[model samples]
Target: MASDSPVYLLLGATGGIGSEVAHRLADDGAQLVLGARSEDDLDDLAAATGGDAMPLDATEFEQVQAAVSHATDTYGGLDGVVNFVGSVLLKPAHLTSIDEYRTQIEKNLDTAFNTVKAAGRPMMRSGGSIVLMASAVSRTGLKNHEAIAAAKGGVTGLMRAAAATYSGRGIRVNAVAPGLIGGGENFASQMSEQILSSEAGRKQSEKMHALGRVGTPEDVAPAVTWLLDPETDWVTGQVIGVDGGLGTVRPG
Candidate 1:
């Protein structure tokens, strides 16, 4: 059975989906330790959710370890962890620069690796859950998404391996792969002005999903929360798509 108040460490707590998940977890009676690269953002979220805040750079193993340590120390124990650290690079393979490829790997894959390694130690002692973020593009071919797909693909692979290795220790690992989510200000910033401003471009992107619309941060938060909950203990090593059928279906 799940604890009445599960202690969870949430990385990238300031992002669109992360923020939404933080709030939902808090409402669901989870004690949260919020982490992000920006101290100001962490402080703000900490205040809003009544959670402790830690400055974290998920790409660095030591920082990831420290954040996990802080969560366990502050809350007496850690029950779950959710990582929302990732980037989007809309460029074809040939057009993608070396730097862009490296950035995507560091932002998406490195963060997942560090989070799993650090969190696994404490979580192994007491059964817990870990959730990482992937993307629909990892399983589906999308134009101008080579770099992001590669990085998120690595994330999916990492999550599955970690889940298999640690299940014996009572650790459950899973991932949520979402489609293009709308209403993310930071995500919008990553897009070209033309894509953001063009009505045709926006409509085309929406039509890619079987739902006939883009997703939102709200669309993903519930799934993350469910995976973290102890009630879903039987589920692990799965890459559940909260992608509005984007990965499995094509709208005619």
Candidate 2:
């Protein structure tokens, strides 16, 4: 008989990246707790994947706590938590408002904070994977990405710090910094705009990477799965870039 599959808690399951990750994990035979602000979206994802679904507002602490409890209570334990909730606020930094700044920070960074906190209890008890989504722009400068860059940079920092803090407890924390992943709702419109606006825009963006194309959710999900696998027990405190050679390029 096959071994019982471990369960994973997937936040932001309604999102393009999060949904892709959820499907990939499900295909690999993981039971899941799918959470998002939209009950409709979560319900649809859960039905499609045969996973448990819960409506969660990552911005609300009580909601996150409740969601985590539901997952643990339902599954007996959670083997991983993917903090894939984030925002990409693109605009001139000076044009950004105090409210916008706060909202951006809360939307992108605080969700991770609360999710990690709420999930840590079950994760520590069982020794599991904790994956946070960072971004290549956290370390690289891109126009109109100041707010998001700052928020995601905090995520990278949290990954390293949490990895160090939680290692002894058997909870491994890691991050994936992806550059220009296509087919996600977050970037679909912008990507389409950029791709169709001009041949020069497409060429310039592609030339920025050695791989000559943008990445996809599938391109990034494997690394996450590997990191969470028992095979990678020795790997921790690492941030892998799924940036399609973008990080390795030199400006000439």
Highest TM-score, which number?
1
Tell me the deviation in Å of residue 152 in model 2: 0.6
Error of 2 at 130 (Å): 0.3
List per-candidate RMSD values in Å: 2.4, 2.9
TM-score of each: 0.94, 0.89
TM-score of 2: 0.89
Model 1 agreement with the true structure over 62-150: per-residue lDDT tens digits: 98899888877777778999999888878889999999999999999999999999999899888899999998999898888899899
Per-residue lDDT of model 2, residues 49-93, tens digit only: 888888878889888888878777777877888877776676779
- Clash pairs, candidate 2, are none
- Alpha carbon lDDT at 28, candidate 2: 84
Model 1 sits at a Cα RMSD from the real structure of 2.4
Candidate 1 lDDT score at position 222 = 91
Q: What are the runs in model 2 whose C-alpha is more than 4 Å off?
A: 1-3, 184-203
Candidate 2 RMSD computed on C-alpha atoms after optimal superposition onto the true structure: 2.9
